[model samples]
Target: MRKTLLTAVRDARSGLALRLIAILSIAILPLGLISSYQTSKVLEKNGALSEIALLDRTRQAAAEERALIQSAFGAVEAISAAASIFDSADIDCDAVLSRLITMEPKYIFAGFVDTRGIMTCASNKERANLSETPFFQDQFANPGGLVSVRPMDATTGGIALNVSVPVVVNDDLIGRFWISIPLTLANDLLGESSDTANLLIFDSEGEILATENFGDDRRTILPQDRSLQEIVRGQQRTFRTHNRRGDLRDFAVVSIVDDTVYVLGSWEPRNTGALTGPSERISLYFPVLMWIVGMAVAYIGTNRLVIRHIKRLRQWMRLYSVGQIDFSQARLQSAPEELEAVADAFRAMAQRLSEQERRREEDIEEKTTLLREVHHRVKNNLQLISSIMNILIRNTDSEEAKHLLRRVQDRVMALSAIHRYVYMSPKLSMVRADQLLEDIIRQLVVVGSADEPENKVSMSTRFDPVELSPDQSVPLMLLATEAAINAVKYCAAANGGKPWITLTLQDLGEDHVKLSVENSRSGLAEEQDSDTDHTGTGLGSRLIESFVSQLDGTLEINALPDRFELHVSFVLVKDEGDDAL
Candidate 1:
């Protein structure tokens, strides 16, 4: 599997489609990069806008709370100014406070606490010790207008906003005048907002005074790693963080009453525009998608418009190279003009080559037939000459002259045998050296043995297959004939042994061959000495030497008492046609 994948990758790297894809990718790279960068900028801008919008919503939600606090401060100041009137005799402080509460329905309790923490001029009949309470003590120490949240107000008996003001008449400081506003009334005043956001109003101490739209799972909506005090300390107008439940949320903090109260609004991050939410993710991947799409288009276009036709042309050329002469232009018909022209050029070249090959083959056949006829006529003419010599030899009365004529006739027959084999063989240029040598040796032995029928000469021939061009075969055969004839002429039984002649053709490997002709020596010492003299004529020796020179062979002769051996070794000559192939 790994090898298959590697092969596929290697093929892809070499293919035209990959090259085209690379070019297209380079061309589109800048545009893709620019698109991605612009998308990122858009996302950043949308994020800033989202933060601003959240802060605006938080400030808007705290508007009612701001108004209620302002009204409480106004009421406390009005009651403090009226403290001098309460100092006169015959004034009903409780009645005055009750009527005041009746006029302002948002105020649940309105009263004045003296320096000793004695409740007087109260709106309700319930009495509460003022001095021991934290709000009263704080007011006593500070002696200024204050707004405080009470979890369980001593006067109202519920969560309420304690707005207090210092009570003083002229230069004399008396006590504190305070109003209790129920949290339920404050929530009613604030009302509900349109957006699905959780609103929280907390004081400077991080104590949550009022909440709107908060669920029972309040911890889930709040920041997991931070407290309200940390958020107030940071004083960040807007921020983004994951809530306790691991849900991402955007938060906005706005001051409702300058360092005293702050409102925090949290909601799920909103999609400001196109580059937000799911669209933001798409924007981030847009560049990669662009590159992939471009490469795919390029690959498809290149495969269809170019590579397919080129491969078809390649296949056609391969077929033509392997001798498939049939040609067709239809396959490239759908190709572009450039590719079609290339196919046309190749087709024309193939046609010319095919025509030339056909003509050359015809010429070779005609020449081969003419050459074979020439060799056949030459063989017949040489036979006729030998027959004429036979008639001359029979007519002659001198024994020496007849012997010479017969020798000449024997040489003529050897030449005739070479031409006969040439025309009879399938290949005109090359002949099998072993077969030609065997035939020549056998014929020579037969002629020599016939001269003395009583001398029983056993001739054995061994030929190994070897091929040579006609030029080499002719000389090789002539040399073998001369050597075999000499061997046969002197062959005799040694010491009551039967006379024998052995002719051998051996392939010595590496384009070399050896021919051997050996015959048993005559038993008589005088006859063996005469055998070394080559039939008392130097003509046979000269002829053998000339034939050996023509064959470019090295000749060796060994005359032992038992036998005479002649061996020739030569490099086989290869045909020109075989070399070309």
Candidate 2:
């Protein structure tokens, strides 16, 4: 089994399939890989640059917002130092703070905490302790200085940015002044956008101040964003990263202004028109797709053009080896050039073989024709010899010599008829047995009627048309003819001269035939059947026995005082040889 497999693999046609597959794989693989790599690089390069471009624009926007917040916080000092308002007697703190709130809508609250952390000039009578807030404590630690504590909880709205400053009277601490601004204003400042650009502001302490994607149906801030933490810890001014939903990637520019970290970035959603459309995506992976398609095409083409054709060619050559030359079977339609050329050559070679075969057949036919002509001429020659023998028989004085010459004449005439039948036959070496028997019987019946005119012998034939090869026909015919002649000649001597001969020839099945000649003789028994036996030692009788034995047949001879019967049964041949038809 292993040897058979190895042989199959080593076969030329099998190797051709392998060679073609290898060649195509080698040619297409690198091309696909290189093309895919270059295309993806180009796509990614342009995409990152475009995101960075949008990020830069967004960074500028973030900077403007950050400056606004910082300026608002910076102005808190001037607002707190409004001596016209704060230092005035019977100060209406609520009206003044409410007026400031009306002036800057972003300021959610305004108040002053004294050295005891109590609201002295309060915006609201009920107020939270400022000393607990980081910026309020941080301000008193550095008096008259402002502190921003962001990512702060708002009192009534959203997340807030808190800024506080310590107020002093001649180096004596008075209170801490502070204001709160909500980040919702910052979100309102930068409206929803088409790009993946979003805003993020975290404080210096690595706390997430705010996150805003700010688009239709997009989250403003993702809870527990680890990527944001990585950005804050890392030292990259502008870092590139993909979003949590891997498909969308961003290039972010982190800017620090007034102690706030502002991150501006744009993401490219990998799934959503990242490279315009499907054609662009295909271009990015063009090499990979091409490689796959190339492999498929190579396999199918090799099977069709190389392997299949080679197999068919091998099959045809095998048929040709056994003399089955069918040129049309060798045709390979719509094949590759090299294979087609081979098929063309195969067709040409098969054509030559067909022509050669045709010529050989013609030569054989010509030889058969010449052989038939030879038989015709030999028949004519034998008939001439029989005519001469007839003259010798008529001129003879002795009865014994006359009888021998007549028997010899009978033999010569039977041989002449044999040759004549062979000449008339379509094939040189085959003759129809029934026709030869009928012809020979007619001639001998004429002779039997001539010698005894008063007892004219009647002839009846029963036979099938059996095809006999050249060697079988002559011997079988002579044996039958000799039996008929002896019966015809002796019937008068034994049965009062009124002769009636019945010739029986039949297909006996199993490639065999039976020939029988029964004749009435002149005297002796009143009735006799075919099984009745008598012996004769004449030359014709001996010749009949010789011929029958030569034909490998069974001969049954029964000679009664008044009748004689002869029967021979034999097999026929049907192959192309001396014994065949």
Per lDDT, the best of the predicted structures is 1
Q: List per-prediction Cα lDDT, in the order shown.
A: 0.78, 0.67
Q: Tens-digit lDDT track for model 2 on 25-78?
A: 787777667777788778777766655555566667576566656766676677
lDDT, candidate 1, 188-260, per-residue tens: 5445653567777776667776675333664466777788899888956677788888888777788876677
User: Please, what is the TM-score per model?
Assistant: 0.53, 0.44
Query: In every candidate, how many clashes are there?
Result: 0, 6
Models, CA RMSD each: 11.8, 14.4
TM value for model 2? 0.44
Give the distance in Å from residue 89's predicted Cα in candidate 1 to where it truly belongs: 49
Candidate 1 C-alpha RMSD relative to the actual structure:
11.8
Cα RMSD, model 2: 14.4
